[model samples]
Target chain A: MKMSGAQMICEAIIAEGIKTVFGYPGGAIMNVYDEIYKQNKFEHILTRHEQAAVHAADGYARASGEVGVAMVTSGPGFTNAVTGIATAYTDSIPLVVISGQVPLSLIGTDGFQEIDAVGISRSCTKHNYLVRTLEELPRVLKEAFYIARSGRPGPVLVDVPKDITGEIGEFFYPSEVNLPSYKPNYKGNNRQIHKAAKAILEAKKPLLYIGGGAVLSGAAEIVRELAWMTQIPAVETLMSRGVMGAKNPLLLGMLGMHGNYASNMAMSETDLVISLGARFDDRVTGKLSEFAKYADVIHVDIDPANIAKLVDVDYPIVGDIKTVVEKLIPLLKEEIRTERYQVWRDILGRYDELHPLLYNDSDEVIKPQWAIERLGELVGEQAIITSDVGQHQMWAAQFYPFDRPNQWINSGGLGTMGFGFPAAIGAKKAVPEKTVINITGDGSILMNVQELVTAAEHRIPVINVILNNHFLGMVRQWQTFFYDKRYSETDLSYQPNWKMLAEACGGIGYDVTTKEEFDAAIKDAIAQDKVAFVNVAIARLENVLPMVPSGGALYNMLLEHKEEK
Target chain B: MEAVRRVISVVVLNEAQVLARVSGLFAARGYNIESLTVAPIPETDMSRITIVTKGNKRVIEQITKQLHKLIPTFKVIEHEEMVEKELALIKFPIEESLSDIQVLCQAYNGGIANVGEKMVIGMVTDEPARVKHFIEAAKRYSPIEIVRGGVVAIER
Candidate 1:
């Protein structure tokens, strides 16, 4: 059927099984918006800001594992979506970002409402295409979705010129993408796999370091089985939080700058480090050379470029983490030698017993850590917890013990402040039967607060727990330590009442000041059967403890509330 | 510990100063991609760049992180995991026997790869490391025309 480029874009989305899209209409994208109006096939969410629309779409993608689609116009509309696109890119979340552009004739001529979106978003997307012809619409959309969901997963952008969208074309969604340059290596070389297994078997003390790719590749069970069979204790990165149940004896908790002492120590001491689906970010390896100095590393990641990028690997296996682990599991002998396991366990247990997370106070305001811990206890291991960036995010990461893979979605690499709200929406949408809570800071929530409207419109009841400290707590904490408590611009004074904001967005909202109030508000929010926000006023001066100073070693962490004059 | 280094070749468009854009990408991302060599393809308006970088798997992935985003970037293939070859011509002493040098050149796939006059041109199309090793081996047979072609990659 002949259709305009804008109509074809929408049709491509529908063909790809997208039931809803989040976006705001603007000058350059008016045609696409108009086309959206004619089609009742897909629901288009009108957001207060372009940023919120992109974030909402990002949330949808994370939850559904389908490509989250968002549409925005030129200039500011496209610019606003940059942060969300970067967030999705850094976390390897699949997203399809469609932005309208000024006409081809007007491009590079300082045209009205025009900005070089392809240029601006170049660093933040997997691949980007500027559709110059209506005939190219279907192919661009197909490639965009293919690139977004394939190999390590990231955001792809298709910038359609406004005039092109009105041009006629015969639309057809190709069942396959034949990009010669885009073939991703999914199987490890047999020699590399053998070398990895040999290294694992020969080492006296081996550590299995897993990351978000484990969950992305569905290798959580295989990771656990490998650890169990090899007698290696496993340490997870922040993105891989729920890959292994926290209660498992072999699980050594998160390993990074903010990771537990045991995990960090295990990483430092292990003779053989078998890292699966995890990049060696500077956060995880304080001083790259010093990190795993004693270890002969066997790095396995689906992205081939990530194999020897950070810490050097003795054996590099490039393939899907699940595939590599599945292959390696049978190659090694399963003779259970409990000696190395007991030694590591004893060390980790001692550290856990020594520097246990503690909070001492009888303050009227509810402690954010305690609130998160209670939520973890109340929801048990079934709930998916998403968080925004701040002190609250750190607390949730520390206190919430996830028992399954793909739970605890948060912005890790990019550290985007407002990711929690939209991510929760996506998680809730993906698994509607399971409870999803967005534990966000007041500063972070305000960044993408408009997503509440999307949640309300879709009837996705994602409970948002706002840790209202009236400050960008993390920055404020940094100022307190480094700037001699001047309090700079971190304090957010003129904040709207969250309850009123939620009400205006057509969702339930509650104000909680104490532990009892927080518990009651949570109960109420959970029972509302609608998108709800529980705003709990938390201590403003609170800091995320065990912070490894930038460029400092992992062992050199500054504990919270340390003894002082 | 001393840092290890690997040389990488990137093929790109040879247009209005695209070298800066490629170099800027590496610089802005804090990726120290060392010793970059960019020159136009003999016939076409495309440039091939060879960059020497130091990293493990993670670092290399991060270096090429945004390469695909460049508008003019048609493709990015890391030559380390592919079948690659580079050609070099060296002018040696005329007294040196052609047969002896040809035997050595044949062993490195340089004999038939290329041939010239006073300069016994040899071509070695192997892995980048093997190419480097071949270049080092050719250095012993001193002749003049020492020119090396930019690296190109093709997956096996």
Candidate 2:
């Protein structure tokens, strides 16, 4: 059927089964926006800024396991969305972003509101396209979704020229893509899977190092089952939380730079490390050469490049994490360990006791860790909690005790600040019945706090728990420990009355300085069926500890309060 | 293992600034591209990109694997067993003996592509190493200028 480029886009989006799209309209994208309005194929969310639109899409994708869609005008519009796109790129979230560019005639002439959108976003995107003619628009749009959601999922961009969106053309969506050289391995090699199973059974101490790929591939249940059947302990990276149940016996807490003592110790001491859908990022492996030195590493990821990028892999199973883990579960069932791991468990248990995840319980003042703990306790870790980067993010990742896959979402790779609130709104939209909360810091919150109006106006009721420490907590912590106390511009003392800011934005707000106030404020925010912000003033100078100093071994953990001499 | 220079050739859908995506991949990953060339393939909807880079076995494999990830990419050839040649053009004063230069170029499949009243242009088509050797060998002629193009290769 012949259709306008904009109409074809709407048709293709409907074909992809997309229910919602977040975007902001501009002159360049007016036609596509009009087509969307006419088709009524998607729930169009008008966000305050282009950046938030992408964040919302990314959050929705991560939380719902759907390919999230975001559209915006070209130039400044897509440039603003760069951070959000880069955030998804780093964490491997499946997202399709459609951006409108200047007309073909104006391209490269620096047309009004036109920058090289494709060029700017090329590196951060899994794949990107700039449609030249109407003939390619339908196929390009289809391929964008296919590329975004397949094979180690990441964000993909399709920049549509304004003229093409207005031009009429024949619309035909291909049933299948024939990317001969781009075929992704979803099924594991039988021989490698069996060898991994044998290695797991023979090893005296085996550790499952799961990452975000497991969550994206829907392999959390399989991962938990493998740990259960094999009686092997596992550790979750920042992105891999909630894969194992809180009560799962074979589970170690979050592992890496700011991870639990037992988890890092287990990673260092294990005989075999089975990495599931997780890249050996610098954060996870403190010092590449010494990381998991005692272990034979088996890496399982959909991306072959991730297998030995940072650390050597003894066995590489390049396939989808969920698929690989599902197949491994059966093979491992027959090869269950004959020897008990009680001794190994005992040592890790002792380590956990010796270096417990600690925070001074302060009744006189509010503690960031306490607030996160109380929030988790009140509404278990089952709620969808997204966090911005900083100490609060690390604290949430560590103390929340996540036990549900896809429930705990954050900007892990890019460590992007200003991502949480908008993302929480998106998550809430994705899973309306579930509670959605943005655990943020003063520094990170202010980055995109303007979105308060979007949440209030749109009735996207997402609660924001701001840890008001008046400083960039993570940077301050580093300076306090490493530097000679030359406190730079890390302080953010000058701030608005957060409660007033929320109230002015037509949202419920509360300022809590004590535990009682914090507890009550959280309850009030949850009970209120409206957008809410709870600003909890936490103790200043507090730090996230058990940090592996830069370039240090995995085992070299630094305590928050070091004993003198 | 020590790092060695490798030539990677990629065929991608001929599109706008696909070279940016091709070269950007290596730069973003901190993989150095010593030399790169791109031109449209005849009678096909594709362009061939040749990138000269230095890396160990693992790094080279990563470069090739990542190249396959780009959307426009249709094929990536690592040139493991291939006939490869890099062209270097030299401009020397007309005073230098054209016969002597031709003899040196003959060693590396060289020829005089252009001759002017003031200067003569000599061309060499050979393995990148031999081209470099020819350029060094022709230096005694005091060549005024040298221009080297990216490597182009075919399966052996």
Candidate 3:
């Protein structure tokens, strides 16, 4: 059977089990849009901007562990999607970004809306293609989905010329991808696994350092099992915040920059560090010379390039995290449920008690931490939570207790502002049965507030809990501590009336200034299955405490605002 | 440790944008490629690309690891110890004494490939380092032009 390139794209998408697509129609993609309209098989959610489209798709993928689909026209459309592409790339989110290009003949003719989409996005994209012929469309689309969802997943772009979409072609999607060079190593070497197991068993104080890989690979169960069996305390990176149950006694909070004192201290003093699916990034391994200085590291990750990149490792096992952890579990025959780690746990417990995460609990204003904590308790542990970058994001990470994998989503790698609301929309769409919430900052909400209109118009029903601080609180906190407190452009006093803005976007809005108001607003949003905005008025001077200063070792936490010594 | 020269080869599907993907990977990681050559096999739908880069052990390992991640990339061979050669053609003014230049080129396995009315072109194929030495020695003969192709390597 013969099909046009546009139809082949649609058929391929349907074949790949992709049910939803976040897209915006444009000049070059008019034919594709027409086909989409004709078929009406795909759920195309029109975002306000191309960036939001890709980000929404990324959020969907992160939430569901499936490839997210996105489409837009060429030139500015591709340019607008660049940030989302890079954001997804850095975080290893799987997304299929389809951009309609100018006709092949008019490609270099300075055609209107013709920009080199493939070349411009080459650096950021994991892989990209500019489709030249109609016959190549199915294979390109097949490869796009295959490459996007396979082996450390990332965004893959396929630029289709406008004419190709209309040109007739033979359509056949491959049952499996045939890229020999791209087969990821999925099983760990038995020798390295044995070595890692031996190291874990021998060490008196073992710390399990986990990251997004644990959650992405669905190895949370195995990780928890290994930690419990070895009686090893664990600390997670910001990306893997919720992999361990928040109430678990052995699981320390996040480590690195804004990590807890106990967690960072544990990392510093541990005799053995069993790194699982987490790269020792600069943020996590501050002052690399001193990071885990005393530990014999056993790092396991799928990406070989990330192994021993920033820190040395005693046992480097390259394989899928889930597979590796499964292999390592049975090797530890010695039961470590005994009190060998009593001293280590006691030391960390003391740190936790001495330097607890605290914020000014002034009666006059609602604290962001209090608001987050309030919602965290009311919302189920399995609720999907996304956050924009800044103080609010830190507050959410600190206050929220996630018990399930993929429950907490945020822009971890790129730290893009305005990621949360659209991401929450995507998450809610992906998992409509679960409650999805976006905890954002006053400064971040303004970056892509137009997304509010997308939610309202589409009835995405995401609860937007904006921590309304009058200043860019995180930057202001940094300036107050690092600089001479000469607050330059950190002031965001001229922000919009968020409640009114939400209402203007045709959503229900509430202005919560106190605990009572916040409780009512949050409860109301969770009760109703509609797009709800609750702007919680938080104090401007509130800072995320227990922060390890940039380039400072993890153990050197600055507890400046603590009341006790 | 100081950076050292390394030869790497990758076999990839003979398709458009494969080269761009390989080059883009290096560029994004800030790894510099000294020289690159690619050619399709006569009977197969695959191409072999050879690249020379200078980096320390860790950097070279990282480059190799990253090269393996490319979708089109089939195999990445980082030459631990390999036989390598590069070709260089040097054009000298016709009036210059050719003996010295010819001796240097002959030692590197080449004589004058061409002797024109105004210029004499000496071609040499040898180990990359020896080719470098030949080019340096031929520079004293008032060479007008020099063209060097990328290195090709095979494991010894």
Candidate 4:
């Protein structure tokens, strides 16, 4: 029964059914790392940086549907993990990050490598704790996990002082957490469900607005069924990429800036929007005053604060999306199904055909869209795709045929640049049998290029497909449009030889110029047993089109590029 | 739905950073907090925080929901029938008309609290709107310094 705080941490992790964690060791957290070294209960991935560790844990959580665990030491380590924590926080990913702090006696004296981490991360984290005593360690650990994986999941941080980890304690991990202030509603009210069902029955042109909350709550099957049963067309947000599946007939694709014409038009025309686990973010609501202007909204989310925060809702239901959808499913009669929405679907389908996502493909010089489409074809439904934020990310979202929940993982809210490679590594680790790929840009890949060595060391076999445009394509597109081609510091033409860089990092590398070479490189990369990087050269001046031009109405989209004097 | 002043009472666990967490949400979201008061509840390890802010019905609903979302917060009450009070202390020059100032303070349910050689300090506890009026009226006495406490509210 008597154990050191370090042992208690290990015991608690085991008790929580955590099989792996990601972290980088430091002076303050040495004792915990020592305990990690002694325990064989969980695997600890030693990342190149503290940031990547948290991101890898986030990816693991996203891919596995389990609460991710990560640890790092004080000061710089804690600060480095802030972006990853914020990224997970914004996306509602469940994560518990353990941060080692300075000794209790040396905390406020401005000792070496000491920062008010709990204070700094207070706003970003769902909840946080500064562990002062060894006795409360077990309970804190339990509550941290419980709060992280509960309703409207998010990242939680626990700052453990160095002295506390070294002190002896009696370890007792609680099976259940009982916080008087924290109880999440999981069931929808019957009357509200009835009201929503009635609204759906009356809505002739209803649209299903799906977001990451649906993905997080595992409401994909129910949502897809609801869309089909109700004959409602669906549109996905960036975070909810695969929830509606790429092949669904009712799916209008992503709806926002850079979203397809059909989806945006459908959003503009729909009479009712059933918002399942989706917050009406500014990006989704291009111009707030005109967004879904004629629509009655039924916003259902686990978080009460999200409902009507930006857009007013006619029917607001605060509960788990899956549970609420399940309750509402039984209320709908077969008579609710009719051909009333057929005309609406036809209108959207016509829009899709009129302004389809198009790009000119060349055999000599590979286009990013073509490359992503080819990659999607080669890596079918079985692969998990992660992408960094940029032109390539948008392309992947546009092209990848993700057919299931959690099949596509990316930083949606934070849009962290260096997210793809480490996330792919974590996804591969979570599901070793499945192939994992990071579709990255030349700029984003370099941000976390050091993690290539981590993947190589573990032989994670995560393929990094670089869409090498030699420039920040998204920013260049903006500069070309708004700034009159005054491209300031957006060019990365003078870059490292990626092949040599990958070779140096203990991974196989390929320099792909033509479409044939790109295809060959990807197939060969997947065939390899080690980490592989395929640097494919894409067209330099390509832009992600169908933009709303910031603060413009969603329906007012610039379909393609035009030369203007 | 027009912008109007609303008072909300939030009960939260007494912890080191609970106040920071509660206030940080408002600061981060650009929500306005006009006045805030915090004091521990008797015989319990909990504190009641009263916040007065200006928002429309939607914004006030969001603020209350956000406050309720905090892990340490136990209850958030936006009472329809409530009694609100604010305290204001004003220091006046000793040469001012003491009788007139005392009468004015009494009109606002208060009186002079201290008489020092250099100044006279008057205190008043009244409704927040009346407290505003009392401060404005005391300005005529050429007060040396004035301090106003945050509003605290309770359901009637």
Best by TM-score: 4
Question: Best candidate per lDDT, number?
Answer: 4
> Which TM-score value belongs to model 2?
0.97
What lDDT does candidate 2 reach at residue A484? Answer: 68
**Ranking under DockQ, best-scoring first?**
4, 3, 2, 1
lDDT of 3 by residue, B1-156 (tens): 689988999989999878988888888789989999999978999999999998887888889988887777788999878889899999999999878768878999998899889988899999888888887887778889999988999888
Give the clashing pairs for model 3. none
Q: What would the per-residue lDDT of candidate 3 be over residues A308-356, giving only the tens digit for each residue?
A: 7877789999888889988888788454444777788888889889887
True contacts kept of 3: 0.85
Q: Could you give me the TM-score of model 4 versus the true structure?
A: 0.98
Give the higher-DockQ candidate: 2 or 4. Answer: 4
**Which pairs of residues have clashing backbones in candidate 4?**
none
Q: Which ranges in model 3 have alpha carbons more than 4 Å from their true place?
A: A333-338, A562-565
Docking class of 2: medium
Better of 1 and 2 by TM-score: 2
How does chain B of model 4 score on TM-score?
A: 0.98
DockQ of each: 0.14, 0.67, 0.75, 0.88
Q: Interface Cα RMSD for all candidates?
A: 4.6, 1.7, 1.4, 0.7
Model 3: how far residue A425 lies from native, Å: 0.8
